[model samples]
Target: MRNVLITGGAGFIGSNLALKLVESGSNVTVLDNLSPQIHGDNPELSPLYRSILGKVKFIKGTVESRQDWNDALVGIDTVVHLAAETGTGQSMYQIKKYSDVNIGGSAILLDLMANEPHNISKMVIASSRSIYGEGKYLCKQHGIVYPNARSAEDMKLADFNVKCPVCSVSVELLATDEESKIHPSSIYGVTKQVQEQMFMITGQSLGIPTVSLRFQNVYGAGQSLSNPYTGILSIFSTRIKNGNDINIFEDGLESRDFIYIDDVVESIMLSIFKDEANYQIFNVGSGVCTDVLTVAETLKNVYQSNSSVSISGNYRVGDIRHNFADLTLIRSKVGFEPKIDFLNGIKKFTTWVNKQEIQKDLYEASIQEMKSKGLYK
Candidate 1:
């Protein structure tokens, strides 16, 4: 567990994790393609990467390349697989690209683990909350249930709440536990599910310790504001900075669990040394649900922006109604608890965003790209 390799180690979560590992005396190797979506094609390294410069080995490559993986895996005994296409919306139209990078890339890594001789004894794969589409809910009539993804027709009518399948009554969102059913409404979630299943199945055969962390909406200071594909906070911040109104989808009551970067890194660090985390899937999140409207308003207040915030009552396919993690498993298993609350974390993030040079808000343009491909209506 000393010599560690982090795939996609140059991005938001990856970069933060690498810094912690390096600080703790672990030999860290980062394998990243630095996709132009996150970093410009001919761009300087992100400020996060620059902060960790000269401290660890950096490989500019993709996870699918065998040679690059081999080079990155040299003397590495632990692998943290974080590289993947992240946009849930963009994933709808860019099906092949998402599958190739997420599922196919993880397959290559597992194949290397099986066929290649290496010192890999431990592996951690990043899973997503999206797998439990709409998440676990409770009907007043029905005790506990897993609601289905809201239909476009229903969303068209502005019915943004999850309803019981049997009674058709609006259900309440309970904290989704790891035991929740796997019903991903998006292609990205499906790929992540495949990636996690592969790691667990293969790790068992190879007698390697494996951990799958279902990360909630992860955000923090180092997050790339340039990437409009993910990070609602970053996207909103970018738009507000550019004097653009924040577009709220599906009435803005839809909520998600947002965990700070430091908390996420702590969970991974725990998994590395914790035998209890071996061959287990833990939900890593802030354990609190914050609605889209709240998120937009908070960002606006923090920035003191005159940007108008409005909800369209419009929705996207494969989007969930409400979901937050049940931290019971992770806490009981590894004594993991989120330290940063939502307000404090957002303030820290806003402070970081204010320091960085303002960039073009690509929110609408990215949505337009999705619309052109018929992914967004």
Candidate 2:
């Protein structure tokens, strides 16, 4: 069994990936600070404090610290770096915080991996499509405003460009390929780009195989519903479940390529084991774009419940009008294909949300909870 270290393994994507590695009979070690912001005050995460945790070896620590990296790297053969301060809008205000973890922490990890005794062979990083920024290519094709209707001819070109009309962006913007230019609009995206570069350079210099997987909007079970800074699907589902109004920041026309957690995990696994994916970057997405309004409506339909939705003119700063992923690289490399369609993924997510016992909160409340738990401290 290969010894694998997963940083930020308590968070949604990291945790899901950890679970997958364990089930595949790998010796998985999860290194996490369990920042109350991500894990919450739930006692279940603590070994001495709870009985409901998974079987992987868990270490409570920060990736930003050198000592934590030293402790976690012992006997590790692979590292899947997924930790980041992932708030696009909030990063505008807290640029330093985003850089500290995403860039600084990653730099430290790469440095350690290079000097370590076990000689780490492979590393995979969790990247974001935000690095592409507000796709100018999309703006040129669809105009500043979205088209009222599109035809097969439009779709063919869109298929070539990878644009989305309802969102007023191209699949070229949505389905960003490996060659897509990096133009980060937010501090978060900027840091992710830096993080990717660090791994690429370090891996090449150190003779270690590194891969970066640019993930689309990922949503599934175990995501924190309390934070508006993360997990839109969870936030929407929880709000509708509680008889609260779901807020759409824009006209609900902006589209995103949302990928399920399972598919994302599979992509990571493929990246790790497959020699063909080394020193490469791949976009992990469903290759389809859906608007926010459609997602809200689908949630309402799946739950068989009625909930109000309000579309506000205010939108988050640096928020992409439309973004999706070009799946040509990953599909060709690992034979990766998203099996769960949008409606099916929504149904699964809604069902999971319906079964949860915990109460969900909005943006301000989420921040307040994080502060109260001493996460920021």
Candidate 3:
């Protein structure tokens, strides 16, 4: 991992990763188009892109272009592919954009490495927990089960709990492991699933070490607060800052594994250099489930804001009820464990949010986009 190339290296995770690698004496090169949605209209002036201004060899390009991949791959030994369209609800309509960028871009990178001569020795892809859909659960009669998406009919009646596919009984959430089912409920998740599979297969054929890290809800300082389609922490923070009431989806019991940014970066670092992590898919998370209501309450408390937390019975089509990562595989294989818990992580994130300029609340507009497509009730 001497000379590294990080696709989408100007974003939250990528900028943090690039800084860490540079501190470790690795020559870092970044390839990012600096999308206005994430980086704002003036990308060059955006804090994310400016964070890596002189620290790395930055290339303003997109992964969909083969010439961009060729330019970014020069003399690079390792590739951490983090470029993708990550909005789950938005992906339901923008199927072509997500597929072309996430899957097509990945195909180009692997095709170049497989056919063209390169010094690439290792590859680490950023996979999402969304690939597991409703994730793992335990039922009294079924023992352990992988439930499907909660139905619209059930959700319309305010019954948002995931039921066992085998018995149709309400199931208890379990820590989703690496061997869980691969049925994605959204187009974004499907793209990530394909990206991971393609990388692992091509890497094995090329005789290069490959690792896939199925990251849970990653949030911390430096994340984009302006992006309404993803990153609940950031979205909630933006709403609170604008003095707008925070409206949580569903019954507000939908839980997720919220891992801090530093912990996520550490897991990726371990994967980059560890020999045991080769040809393995590991779950990266804090291993604890935190519900959406708790997140809203904590943010409001931490920010000392008067914004109310409302639990709307409304739900989206591709939303999951609950999912958390089982860290046994990552901990034993890569020796990675999260340091910051939810409370402490939220404190750190809110402190950072306090310093940044308040972003406009676009949550309603985003929801309207989904509602117009009939994906949101």
Top-lDDT structure, candidate number: 3
Taken over the whole model, the C-alpha lDDT of each candidate is 0.89, 0.76, 0.93
TM-scores for all candidates?
Answer: 0.98, 0.85, 0.99
Q: Write the per-residue lDDT of candidate 1 for residues 310-333, one digit (tens) a residue.
A: 988767777888889999999999
Q: Determine which window of 10 residues in candidate 2 has minimal summed lDDT.
A: 143-152
Which residue pairs in candidate 1 collide? Answer: none
Off by over 4 Å in 2: 43-54, 136-174, 364-377
Q: Which segments of candidate 3 are over 4 A away from where they belong?
A: none
Best by TM-score: 3
lDDT of 1 at 331: 99
lDDT of 3 by residue, 109-170 (tens): 99999889999999999999999999988999979899888888898899998898988889
All models, RMSD in angstroms:
1.1, 7.0, 0.8
lDDT of 2 by residue, 309-366 (tens): 7776434546666777889889998888988888788777777777776455665575
